[model samples]
Every structure is written in structure tokens, then in C-alpha cells.
Target chain A: MELPAQTFQVTRADLVRYAGASGDFNPIHWSDRVATKVGLPGVIAHGMFTMALVGRAVTEWAGSPDAVVEYGVRFTRPVVVPDDDQGTEIEVTARVREVTEDGLTRLEVTATCLGEKVLSQARATIRTAR
Target chain B: MPLDPSFVGRTYPPTAPYQVGREKIREFASAIGATDPAHHDPEAARALGHPDVVAPPTFPVIVTMAASSQIIEDPALGVDYSRLVHGDQRFAYTRPVVAGDELVCTNTIEDVSTRGGHGFLTTRTDVSTVGGEPVVAVWARYVIRGEA
Candidate 1:
């Protein structure tokens, strides 16, 4: 079954806070000058930040914060933040792939920004009964 | 320059212990907009059987990123930090990390290869408690873009 999609807003301020919280001080995340110099269109969200938002969606679906047994994702594209109040939106959706007799549920996840896939091969296994 | 394939299977010494503080967990969760009660309230976490507030799934990167410096900074390994971008990430948890746990990471070079003039390096980090209890294993792949 297809799960309801969750959307998140990413802004420059959010990136700054994430950098401090996550200890990733790469200038490309905060400085558009640095980003453009690096040949990026503009500032982009950290791949891990996008993954964390997806993780939030997964845990919310599983009804427990500690339910994840395994999670993985490949960074396919950058989620560019326009340095404005509106920033960008990331939409996360997932589907049930399998459920084990041992109570594990596997989900295939998709995360998109501006209609472009940001992460591919995204999957998570959770202990649904725990 | 391509990463040396010989670095594969090489393991770095365990990093110094990192204290997982409740506020740090709360900060990380809030940064990602994760407002689960288990991540913010110690009482709520304890009610859920965790010793204290639990970390969000990707929180361990904070520790591993620092620990992995051992390899990225290895003079012999020769990683160009400026050109590196994250390619993929994975985590397998034995249990949720709780606040007050002192964690150590042992980093190992899992793979190294080059294709299309781009170098790929994959690192695996074994996270365990200071007392040696296994906690989680994390894998991260970084792509070093070919020099222009």
C-alpha cells in the first residue's frame, strides 16, 4: 500500500542550524557564493539532512521513534535552497515492500524535491510490533 | 587522483569516547524537525524502555564524521576534502542510542575505486559503547569529483 506523503520545508536558516547541530560546516551549504563557485546552482541541503527528514517520516509511520532496524539511501540529486523564506520543499513517500514473520516491515522510500528525485534506493526496515 | 585500492580492509584505531548528551540529541532531532517525545523527554524515553532520550536515526553521523577524519586525513590515503561529496549512507542499528552513553567508533576502509575519472571511497564505522557493547554499524560512500 502507498503511504501518505509528508512534505518538509528547507530554508537557509534551517541549513545553518543543521550544520551547527550536525558539525558539517561545509561552506557550500551556507554560502551561495561558495556554492556557485563550486559549480552548483545554489546552496543545497545536506544529503544527511534529507535522509533525516525521511527517517522522521518513517518513524512517524511506524508509530515509534526507535523502530528502525536498518535504513539506507543514495544521493541522486541536490535539493537546492533558494536562500529565500519559501526555500524548497521535500516530499517523502514510501510503500510497504515486505513484512517478516519476525515482525520486521520493509519499506521502499522515495524523496523528491521540485519534482526531481533527490534520493534513490531508499529503503528502511522497522520493527513494527516492538 | 584515484584512491588506492590497497586501503581497503585497513582499520583505524578506535576514536576517543564521545559522550552522547541529552541536549545534543535534542538539538540534532530539532534541527531535522524531528519532534518525537522520545527524542526530547527523558521521562518519555524511559517510559518507552530507553535509558534516556534516544537519538534520531542519523545522529551517529555526528560522531562518525569526526572519527572518519582518521582516514580522510591519512597522508598515505590522500583524500582531497574539497572535492568530496557524499554519495550514499546506510545504518544498521543493534539498539537505539540513548543519552549518557559513551560511544567509540572504529573506522575501516570498505572499498575504493575509480570510474569516469571520479574516485569513490567507502568507509564503515563500527559504533560501540565504551564498555564494548555493540550499538550500530554505519557505512558512508564519498565521491571525489575528477579534477577539472
Candidate 2:
């Protein structure tokens, strides 16, 4: 079954908050000067931030905060957040790849930003919601 | 400089215990815009059979990232922090982390290789309770780009 797509807005303010919360103070995520020097288009969202948003989508579909048993993703591309009131959007979509006999639901996940895939081989397995 | 493949299989000492707090979980959830009550309200988490406010799945990164510095900062490894980029991440959970749990992480270098002058290092962090009950295992792969 195909899961409903969820879009998340990521802003500079959100990145600041995430840096504080996650303790990842990488300048590439917040400093445009450092980011440009590092060959990024501009300040980019933390790859973990993008994964967290995908995790949120997974839990929303699984219907529980503690549903995940396994989750994984490859950071294929950066999600660049332009400096503006409107940051950027990450679109998360998934399909149920399989359901184990023991009630595990495996989802094949995808996340894209601005029409480019940002994550690859993204997958999550969750306990089937009661 | 390419990473020494000999570092593979090296295990770092366990990190100091980190107490998982309810408010920290809430803050992380809010940062990610995760509105699940189980990540905030203890009562709501207990309703879902958790001992306290549960953390979102990716919350473990906060702990593992700090723990993995043991490998990243090793002078013998010669990893240039400026040239590093996260390539992949994976988590396998035996149980979700909840408030009031004291967690410890032990980092192990699982693989190291150089391809096309770029170094790839894979590290696995085993997160467990202070009492030694495994909670989750997180794997992270980092790529160090060679200077052109």
C-alpha cells in the first residue's frame, strides 16, 4: 500500500533549533560563508534533520511514536535551505514493501527536496500498529 | 591522506553515561516538528506502554554523534574534520529510548577503505543502558573528500 505523502518546511530558524537540540554545530549547516567555502550551494539542512522529518512521517503512518524497529537512509544529496521567509520543503513518501508474519511492516521510503532526491535506500521497519 | 584500513575492528572505550531527559526529548521533537504526544507527555507515553516520554527514532544521533568523536578525533586516524561528509546512517532498535534512561555508547570502527582517493569510514555505535541492556545499534558512514 502507498502511504500518503507528507511535506515538511525546513527553515533557518528550525536549523538553529536543531543545532542546539542535536548538538551538531557544523558551520556548513548554518554559516553561508563556511558553506560556500565548502562548495555547498549555501547553508544546507543537517542530513539528520532531514532523516528526523522522514522518521516523523514514518511514525505518523505507523500510528505510534515508538513503532520503529529499524530505520536507515543514505544521504545522496544535500537539502539546501535558501535564506528566506520561505525556506524549503522536503517531501516524504513511502510504500509498504512487505509485512512479516510476525507483524513487522517494512516501508520503502523516499525523500525529495525541490524535485531532487535527497535520500536513497531509505527504509523503515515498524511493528504493526495495534 | 587516506584513512588506515587497519583501524577497522578497533573498538573505543564506552562513553560516559548520558541521562535521557523528558524535556530534551520534547525539545528535539519540537525541533523536528514531531508532534506526537508520546515524545512529550509522560502520561501519553505510558498510555502507549512506555515508561516515560519516548524519544523520536532519530533522537539517538545526539548521543551517537558525540560518542563517535573518539574515532573522528583520533590523531592516528588523521581524519580532517573540514573535509568530512556524512554518507549514510542506520539504526536498529531493540526498544525505543524513553525519559530517565541512562545510556552508554561504545564505538567500533567497522570498515575503512579508500576509493578514488576519497576515504570511507564506517563506525557502529552500540547504545545500551548503564546496566548493559542493549537499546539500539547505530551505524554511520562518513566520506572524507580528497583535496583536489
Candidate 3:
């Protein structure tokens, strides 16, 4: 089974909010100057922030916030958040790889930005409601 | 320079307790646009059998990242914090974290590798109640870029 695609918008404001909430005050996430100096195109979203969005989609698909038993992802590309109002968008989709007799679902996840893959080796194993 | 492989399997002492706060959970859920009442309302969480507001799946990172820094900052590891980039993240949860749970983390260096003039380090953090009831295990991989 495949879950519906979910999309999320990431702006400089979102990055700032996430940084404050997560206490990951990495300047590469907010300051274009620091980001450019570090070799990024511009401000970029935190890898964990991106993973969190995908995690929301996973739980939503499982029909509960507590359904996730295992989740993992590799940051293959940076999702650059422009200083503009619209900023960047990330799209996530997942295919059910296995459904165990114990009501666990293994999903292979894909997240993309600007038509390019941002995460690889992404997978989640979730407990399903009986 | 590659990280010293000898450090693998080294487990650090448990970190100081970090009390999960409802406000923090609410803040994180709001930042991610997760509007589930279970994340913000104790009553809603109770209906779901949780003792308090439930944390989102990725919330454990807040605790584990801070805990893993013990290994990353080890002078013996020689990690260049500036060149470090997150390579991967993983979480395995025994249950959803709830507000007011005093959690402690025990961190371990899981792996270290080098390739293409870059260093790779992977750390695993086990989060549990101060009483030792396991909550979650987090794994994070960091890449230290070689000087150009």
C-alpha cells in the first residue's frame, strides 16, 4: 500500500521557529551570510526539521501520533530556504514495504525538494491500530 | 583525518536528567504544524492512554543531540564542529514521550569511518526514565569534511 503524498512549506520563519524550538542554533539554518561562508547556497532547513515533517506524515498515515516504532533517514541534499515569502517546499511519499502479522508496517519513504531528492535510505516501521 | 575507530563501543555515563515539559512539546508540535490535540492537551492524551501530552516522534532528538555531544566534543575524537554535517538520524521508541517524564541518556559511539578525506562518526543514545525504564534510542551520523 502506498500513502498519499504530503507537502510542507519551509520558510526562513519556519527555520527560525524550529531552531528555537529544537535548540539547534546552527547559523547555517538561518543566516545567509554564515550559510554562504560555509558553502551553502543560502539559508537551509535543519535536517532534523525536514525529518520531523516527514515523520508527521508517517504518523498521520498510521492514524496516530504514537504509532511510529522506528524511523530513520539520511540527509542526501539540503533543502534551501530562500529569503522570500514562499521559500521552499518538500514533498513526501511512502510505499508500504511489509505488513507484519503483528500489525507493523514497514514503509520506504521518499522526500523531494525542487524536484530533487533530499533524503535517501529513508524508512519507517510503524505499529498499526488493530 | 578519520576518526579513531578505537572509540567505537565506548559508552559514556548517563547524562543529567532532562525533564520533559508540556510547553516544550507544544512548541515543537506547533513549529511542525502538528495540531493533534494529544500533543497539547493532557485530557486528549489521557484518552489515548498517555499520562500527559505526547511528544512527536522526532522530539527525542532534542535530548539525544545534546547527549551525543559528549562524544562529538571529545578531544580524542578530534571532530571539527564547523565541518560537521548531519549525515543520518534514526529513532526507535518504546513509547511516546510524555510531559514531566524525567529522562536520562546513556550515549555510545557506534561507528567511525573515513573515506574521501572526510570523517564519519555515528553515535547511539539510549533515553530512559531516571529509574531506567527505556523510552527511546537515537542514532545520529555526522560527517566531518576534510579541509579543502
Predicted structure with the largest DockQ when compared to the true one: 2
| Highest-scoring model, lDDT | 2
Model 1 reproduces a share of the real contacts of 0.89
Cα displacement (angstroms), candidate 3, residue A74, comes to 0.3
Per-residue C-alpha lDDT of model 1 across residues A29-121, encoded as one tens digit per residue: 999999999899999999999999999999998999999999999999999999789999999999999999999999999999999999999
| Pairs of colliding residues, candidate 1 | none
Q: Poorest 10 consecutive residues of model 3 chain B by lDDT? A: B1-10
Error of 1 at A20 (Å): 0.9
lDDT score at residue B34, model 3, on the 0-100 scale? 92
What range of 10 consecutive residues in model 1 chain B has the weakest lDDT sum? B1-10
- What's the CA error at residue A60 for candidate 2, in Å? 0.4
- For every model in order, the fraction of real contacts preserved is 0.89, 0.98, 0.88
Worst 10 residues of 3 chain A by lDDT: A121-130
Question: What would the per-residue lDDT of candidate 2 be over residues B96-130, giving only the tens digit for each residue?
Answer: 99999999999999999999989999999999999
lDDT of 2 by residue, A1-130 (tens): 8999999999999999999999999998999999999788999999999999999999999988899999999999999999998999999999999999999999999999999999999999999946
Candidate 2 similarity to native, TM-score:
0.99
For model 3, the stretches where C-alpha displacement exceeds 4 angstroms are none
Tell me the spans in candidate 2 whose CA falls farther than 4 Å from its real position. none
